[model samples]
Target: MTLALKYAARSDRGLHRSNNEDSVYAGPHLLAIADGMGGHAAGEVASKVVIAALAPLDEDVPGDDLLGKLHEAVVSGNDTIAELVDQDPDLEGMGTTLTAILFGGGRLGLVNIGDSRTYLLRDGQFNQITRDDSFVQSLLDEGRITPEEALTHPQRSLVLRALVGHEVIEPTLQVRETRAGDRYLLCSDGLSDVVGFEKLAETMQIADRQACADKMIELALQGGGPDNVTVIVADVVEEEPQPQATQAFESSNNHMHPVGPTTSPPRPPVQMPPQQPPPHQATMQQPPQQPQKKKKRGRKIAIIVAVSVIFLALIGAGIRYLAYTNYYVGVSDGGEIAIFQGVRGTVLGVGLHRKVEGSCAPAAGPDCRPLRIEDLGATNTTRANEGFPVNDLEAARRTINTWRSEDQQPEPQQPVNCPTPLPGSSATSTPTDVPSLPGETPPGSSTQPSC
Candidate 1:
């Protein structure tokens, strides 16, 4: 079955901004939102250019060809904006973030750049489909921070990649299967930054699309929309026969299907026939369209599987970091006490840690100790402080020495065991020395597990 959308979209200047720097387009199969950046009227121009560039993909595109077509549209937008910036020095920094979706042949073509977002609401679970190309997002990916931390990060607004007049724009693209009851949302950061995802999921459950879009806008306003806000709320419904004229109609306007690449503005609407032809007559001129289901499977199940794999990968990484980076004073193969950087034994077929430079000299080998624990692979700054386990390597040597000194002390003064001197000759046998720890030397022996 062919996939399509029933969507509503709106753009607001917002409470703080004097003018709306956001541009939006919503249609049966094409939905997009752009948030422009820069001062002066450049923001508006950039956003408008982005929407103009992407407006053509609304027409029906086959699943196999959809990805290429989407790329062409985005490249056109990037080039147009870059050319404008080059032509005018004042608009040099002006650029816009574009997030759009093309739905056809039961799959969605996703194109994203900058911080604008795309989200999917399936099976009562809301999942963000696109990742942001921002600085804080990199931190999150590196495991330095959690998703909750990224939201309120002071530098969250600092985007690393955007459509700004770059010679080359690296836009993110993906294709996913679309379902009959699925709902998709595209919005500018003005709405997303202020509105929490929980609230969005709750409000999106409203039956009416317009009502849902309005509620989202209202929530952004209540949160003091600091920038221009744009929203598109679209729900996928069962495909049905659409009248020929209605195919050209959009939620915002009766925009015609853009034919070819041109710098010109939106084309004038085509005049319709006075008498509408029967639905049967329309089919004769055009072949029936078929939806191409590429890898159409259980979407939520796929999500769960992907999430499980990612979670396991993260846990495995954390465990390895903890095990491999451990450093402490321990016994070496030569029976000499020394500081060890890695874990004592092999785990998962890898050493716990390696020897690093430090104050304690390596007696077994001629190598030196690491200057700090960080030299051993604990790059995260949070764990470098005094709270670190065995952080004081020099002090650790002192503790190990105390243990050795106690072991060397003479046994407590107590009553001696009197043995019966039988007539046999076994009274002269000496007592054997007792060992203290695993791999430890005899009590009188010098070397042991120590730093």
Candidate 2:
């Protein structure tokens, strides 16, 4: 089946921002969002430049070339930033996060840099497709912090990577197969940071694309919009959307900076003439139908209840899969090296992970070493405390083995000098006691001296 996108785009300056630094674009074949960072109007310029660089890809592209095109466009945008910075040194520190998707040959080419996000909703399931390039995200991956802690982290807004007028940085790129009913949402951190994931999923379920985008913007503003918010909501459909009135609806009274072709405003309700009863029924009185109506209502309630239960079950299963499939190396309660299955954090006070192997445990095999956390040295000890995430049990074992090899190596000894005896002095004369080198202990002391 031929697939096409029906999309809406919206942006607001938000309550706290003096000017909007976010830019967005939505078209039949592409959707993109950029969140700029810098003081003054430089942020606005950064976002606009990046968005403009990507706007050209909103046309037909071959499936195989989608990723290449996206990468080239992102590099071009980075180059433009460099040129701008050269022209005006004040814009040197300015940069922007980019999250975009290009549709071609019934597939999607996705690229992301910094913290902006892209989410996909299909078959009643919602998931984030792009991982954030941010400090908090790395902490979460290493199990040093939980998702909740990341939200309020002092450096929550610190983006680790972006297109900042310097050397070209590679962006996260992927190609995804699309389905007719799939829906995608691309937005900056302003909306994502404020609105929780559950609320976003609920709003995205709205059938009308425009309505969904509008509700998302409203939710961000309601949540005390601390940054500029931008949103683009698009749905994949088998049939191409027909052209409609070109009127644009403002996202907010404060400011309306929508990019690309905005979806038409909600159409006025059509008035219909009242109809009289049919000729046969006009002469006859209709019987009361409250019982049938009640039966239909009860059936509807039952269906709703069943669907909710199924959805919850699916969500639970997905969570369980995510929790148990991964493994990590960490310090156990006994202060020894250990292997854990599942995530490091807990949910509602229940631990999400379990210690699967302790130092030299029976299941750890003959090569396992009875090593304590302290034996790993200071650097590795810190890593053990944070938990070293691995893809599977084999990888965890490999990590332990590598650490063991490093620990087994002998430390290099420091050289020391001994004074030569005088030619006429007795051969057995005791060496004169001299002050030791700085930071060193004297001879015969518990600590060795540097001569």
Scored by TM-score, the top model is: 2
lDDT of 1 by residue, 1-451 (tens): 4445777776677776655667776655578888888855566667766666665455344457777888897888788778766655556687889899888747888989999999999999998999989899899989999878877889888888888867678689999988989988888888888888888889889988777888888888899877777788888876544422212111111211221111112222232223323311111122223222211211222233324423443454555557655666644444344456645566445455665533344552554322333232233223333223465566655544444443334558666555666797665544358857887655555432221
Judged by whole-model lDDT over C-alpha atoms, candidate 2 comes out at 0.74
Off by over 4 Å in 1: 243-451
What is candidate 2's CA lDDT for residue 234? 82
Best by lDDT: 2
Clashes within 3 Å, all models in order: 13, 0
Give the C-alpha miss distance for residue 427 in model 2, angstroms.
99
Every model's TM-score: 0.55, 0.56
Each prediction's RMSD over C-alphas, in Å, is 21.7, 23.4
Q: What lDDT does candidate 2 reach at residue 362?
A: 72
